[model samples]
Target chain A: MSAFKEFSKGIYAENPVFKQALGLCPTLAVSNSVENGLGMGLAATFVLVCSNVIISLIRKSVPPKIRIPIYIVVIATFVTMIDLSMAGFFPALHKSLGIFVPLIVVNCIILGRAEAYAGKNNAGLSFLDGLGMGIGFTLALMLLGVIRELLGNGSLFGLPMLGAHFEPVLIMILPPGAFLTIGFVLGFFNWLENRRQNN
Target chain B: MKDILKLSSILMLITTIAATALAAVYSVTKPRIELKKQEALNAAKSVALPGADLNAIYDVKGNDKVLYYSGYMDTTKSNLVGYAFLTSGRGYSSDIESIVGVDSTGNIIGIQVLSQTETPGLGTRIEEIRYGESLTWVQKQFIGKSAKNLAVDKDGGEIQSITGATISSRAVTNSIVAGYEDLLKQLKETN
Candidate 1:
């Protein structure tokens, strides 16, 4: 695949959240607000890109039998780094993101990318793949956040958008709301892909 | 046997590197993280006891794992203004931790949720700040209520539960009541 194709595929064609359905846990958990979505997205992206590059660099030396543990250690290091730095620098964001930050260590996208693409690809290509995938994940979370925050809170990014008269759906920001939103979004994307294929 | 040693060696090397990197990162961030936590506690203290002397606040460790802070009006520490303490209760998902301040009379001065992992949008609304308000609506509701009588309206108390978050609301209220009683008992024993 071309370099651009590798970088761009994660945004739409092979989105980690909407398209491929990887890392749905964090996506659904933090998509309650745009700020959270954005924070989580960027945090995950950093871990993904860094881990990808390092994993690709070490892939040749890694014994296949031990690669999974190596990958986990690498991923976990990045997660803890981000977690501590966030706690130090962005205390409010850290408090809000809470357990989800550490949970990113288990997020399938980072490991999946490291194992599948980065393991086989060059470091440079792996970096692009990680960036693309990270951006795709970020965008997907933001879309969910926008929808949920707007309908659920009658606000966008905590700013009142729908005014006082607008009663929020209430369910849109809850767990059920997350499932409902993701289902519709997944359906919509699938519909779009099907239409494109038909045409 | 040779391949096993090689694989084990590689795995060990990777983990050692990972551990070193994490240690470095932790060392760099530890002080800053502590500073942030201290700052948050300080902020919560001031908010919980509006106008209480930040410097004069001191902690009294009770026998039963209860620690409460006494806040005074000045550094001279002559005039006691209020008491602040950390309290927590089981919420829908996680423990709802809060710092509550009460005057010498046991009426709540103010409260600040130190941390909570409750359900977002519904239960987490406990931290939501309405327009043009500094204190969250939930925090404001606790002001001036007698800690002895603290309970959600669901349980026939005066405090109103956050809409759709009765559990979280009840958690905060019950925790405050329990903590306050503990504080009074501790204070009596110490005096």
Candidate 2:
């Protein structure tokens, strides 16, 4: 594949969240507000790109049977760095994100990409792949966050856009709200794909 | 045998690198993290007891998990505004922890849910207040109410429970009341 294609594929054609449906736990848990969505997305993105490059650079030396453990160790280090740094620099956001930060180690997106793409590709190509996948994941979370925040809290990015009279749909910000929003958004994407194929 | 040895060595090398990197990052960020934690406690103190001297806050050494901090007017510590303490108890999904501010008259000045693992929507509404927009937080129900009156309306008290989060609401009210009682006992002992 061309260099640009490698970077762009994860954005839409092979998007991790909407298209592939990978890493939904963190996506749904943190997408209730724009701030949380962006925080998680960027954090995951950092982990993804760094792990991809490191795994790719060392893939040749790593034996096939033990690759998974090596990949995990690398991904976990980056996740810890993000977790500790966020607590120090962005304490409030770090507190809100809570367990999800450490949980990033288990997020399938990071491990899956390291196994499938970075394990075989060159270091540069793998880095691009990671960037594409990370941005794609961030954008998807932001979209879900916008919808839920506006409906659930009558606000966008913590700003109360709706007047005082506006009563929010409480369910939209709850756990059930996470499932409902993702389901509808996924359905919309599927419908769009179907329409394009018909033409 | 040769392949096994190579595999083990490579894995060991990777693990070593990962550990070193983590240690480096942790050392750099440890002081900052501690500072942030102290700042959070300080910020919560200010919010719960506005205008109280940050320097005059002192730990009263509770017997249990409850944390009590006495805020004084000056260095002499003769005048006391009230007490701010942290209370944690079982809620619907997880432990509900709150920092409550009680005035000298035993009225709740303010209550801030410090940390909670309650369900995201219903039970988690305890910490859902807007700062300047409108104070609709579920915890605000306790503000200005006397410690004696800190029960859900269903129990014939002044506090209004969240519609679907009666358990979570009661958890908070009961904890605050417990903290208030403890505060009174400690204050009496000290004075």
Query: Which of the numbered candidates is closest to the native, going by highest TM-score?
Result: 1
User: Candidates' lDDT values, in order?
Assistant: 0.90, 0.86
Please, what are the lDDT tens digits per residue for candidate 1 over residues B90-175?
Answer: 99988999999999999899899998978776788788886667778567788888899877899999887988999999998899
> B36, model 2: CA deviation in Å?
0.5
Give the residue spans of candidate 1 off by over 4 A: B62-66, B132-134
Q: For model 1, how does the per-residue alpha-carbon lDDT over A79-155 read when each residue is reduced to its tens digit?
A: 99999999999987898898999999999999999989999999999999999999999999999999999999888
Here the TM-score of candidate 1's chain B is 0.93
lDDT of 1: 0.90
Interface RMSD, candidates in the order listed: 1.4, 2.3
| Candidate 2 docking classification | medium
User: Model 1, residue B174: displacement in angstroms?
Assistant: 1.5
